[model samples]
Target chain A: MPKEKKIRVLIAKVGCDIHERGALTLLTTFRDEGMEAIYTGRYQTPKGVANAAVSEDVDVIALSDHTGSLPIIAEAVLAELKKLGVTDMPIIAGGLLTQEDVKVLERMGVTGNYGPGTPMDVILTHIRNVAC
Target chain B: MEVFLHNLTGIPRVDEAISLMKARNIRGLTRAISIVENYEEGRDALLNDAFQRASEACFTLGFTGAPGVGKSTLVNAVIRHYRRSGKTVGVMAVDPTSPFSGGAVLGDRIRMQEHNPDNGVYIRSLASRKALGGLSEATKYALYLYKAFGFDVIIVETLGVGQDEIDVARYVDVTTVLLVPGYGDTIQMAKAGIMEIADLFVINKSDRPGADLLKKQVQNILYMKAEKERPPVLNTIADQNEGIDDVMEAIAEVRQRKALQGQERHRKRIVEEIRSSVLTRLAGDAEPHLDEMAGKVLTLSMTPIEAAELIIRRIQKGCLEDDEKNSI
Candidate 1:
């Protein structure tokens, strides 16, 4: 039997930041592009996000961060995934990132680090490419 | 034709998954559900083996109703209640798959995020893909796997349903239908399909006006049934956790009554599972010939009825030939 491959994404927001208009927009965009996107909701801990990704068996983990804790939250989530022996899972971040935060995500091997005003098409294409 | 008990051969992942499931590994449950959800190769083998190991220790609860009835919110409250007692829960939240894109946005988990990383609570979102009955086709198989994994409670939260989408009742041990105040009047309560399936009725958002009126309407609807057979109607403000304890108590009472007829439920579920599996297999086998037959009909070589009959005859003949070959 052949299975239909869907790009399953876990879209989430880390601690204390409830600015979700951007994340919700991106989630809808992913759905429009025919991806199975699930948002774990706001104020999620790194551990919660990591566990949800593994349990949902999502292809990519997209974080919607706005509290300037992108690097910290991304690192913790990556570490938690590592604890579950999930090392190569694709991690992406968007919202409220400075140049330094983007560089930090790059060093940590996170893909598609986008800030506000970045084109939705660019984010979508990058996600499709990485997930595939 | 073959012995349908167990066929773990040619599927190495099943071996690993079974072992993981034995240890209650979350990843194993996740992988097992994915295999069944996608109908991947060896899905039946996995499900068959899971059935053999599955136990009746878990209580399967179903929550279904129209949109925005606070089903997920109520489920969240129930999960907290169960977690406080140190019981393990496995939740499957069903949302509709987009008919055009064949994709879905599973937002149910957003409501249950507080339970994450608890290990005692596992919540998975399912897309109601191609299943018009407010459930995924793999739901029954997923329940078997969850049972094998030894959860104390298994909850299936269905997509917001209309009148006739009551398939969830067939698969669960207890079905709780949620309704908010002002949802409908007495006529809607007396309707046949969704109202008849519930073992319990929940008027969530009971803090709103008309809550008492809805409860009275439900009681009037249940007035015809035997007192023992009547499902209890309870009020709840799920977000603030008001009245959840009463709802839980009503559920326990209903579950006790439901347990008495467990064998009947099991028999019905067996028939349904087999019937659906055979239909799905036959459909898959017949799918490859559809385009050719449609083309023949388009060219006026055959009528639509004749085209369908031809396909059926071919499939029947093919089945006989395969049987003969196996016998030889």
Candidate 2:
């Protein structure tokens, strides 16, 4: 019998801010849920994230940015994704996104907007929904 | 088909494969590690075949310390040192389990973002989830697999707070215990467990106040236990990469000493492994019947003590055949 291939995810935190609690939390959550997640650490640029996504060939790219600069970073990341021809890959954004910000991020092609106190299961379910 | 053949043969064409690994070929190393880690599934044959083909160029180091001790920073320093020497390093950082979510809080990887560009270094963050020893039991297996894949150094950074973290020392040739100054009574809490296993003690954040005093205290404790062979202690500020060279040198020295002292620690490690294995197996065997037994006990069909006795007896009877085989 052939073993099932695990879902691969790339969890990256973009922008100059050093806060990575959300990203780390997501990485661990994915692993515990039996998913293969490649963590890009913290303080990554949009290009770095896009490059990693292309190299890793991850099913999902989860961006965790706690710094209030998500609107700009999301736009840059979406632009990079489009440029790299990776628009098919789901880009989920979490961490400190307000309702209005979420709406804006969605328009920019973000798949999910996760805020503080959001359950990891919710993120996992969302990834499964989008990637599977 | 090539991967399958590689798995069957247990031999890595070391020069070619290691060069591939050193060039940041993550896919190659990842595949090789999977093969080696699953040795019981007959990948050992392939690894043995690869063994003659691979270089004997690997060092395995274990890092453990309390939370907020700047272990990630120290690990970053260590990675930078190895990178400067043109050696490929694999870091496996084990993070604490999130109590709320039953997942890992992989915060350590976030703190060491600068090293991402160094293609020679592969940093993996692992969550310690319900694993008794604080490390994923597969970690030692993973380390050896990395070695087989030709990583020059594999650093296992573990969650530093519990018994599981201390168990990490048994698996590595050198274990460094990281500490920070003025951690208050947290030092006292960890002293008994961590002090015993540390191959070397590192006082990181040396720029902070009380660093010297903390070092003195640790030194004094080691002095008191000098009868049992004390590990050397050093101070470093990992954020700035201070004193990392000295730490690495000390680690190398310890590795050499262990090589010379070979099998002494290995035998002890085997004994510990046996103990843990037996307990885990016993638990697995007992768990399924636990609810049934509890129901019986609740109904007064059997006392709680009697239920436990029955479980032990069953285990004993089950092992009797193996015990006889051993005797014969």
* lDDT string, candidate 2, A21-127, tens digits: 77666666676776667687767888667655643445688888877777788788777666645567788888888788988988877878988998877888899
State the iRMSD of every prediction, in order shown: 6.5, 9.1
Output the number of the DockQ-best candidate. Answer: 1
The fraction of reference interface contacts (C-alpha pairs within 8 A across chains A and B) present in each candidate is: 0.54, 0.12
lDDT of 1 by residue, A16-88 (tens): 9979899889878887888889999999988899879877878889988888999999999998887776787
Best by TM-score: 1
Provide per-model DockQ scores.
0.47, 0.16
Q: What DockQ does candidate 1 score?
A: 0.47
**Which TM-score value belongs to model 1?**
0.93
The lDDT for every candidate, in the order shown, is 0.86, 0.69
Q: After superposition, how far is residue B105 of candidate 1 from its true place, in Å?
A: 0.6
The regions of model 2 sitting more than 4 angstroms off are A1-10, A17-41, A46-59, A65-90, A94-110, A113-124, B1-25, B28-57, B163-165, B183-191, B224-229, B270-282, B297-309, B312-328
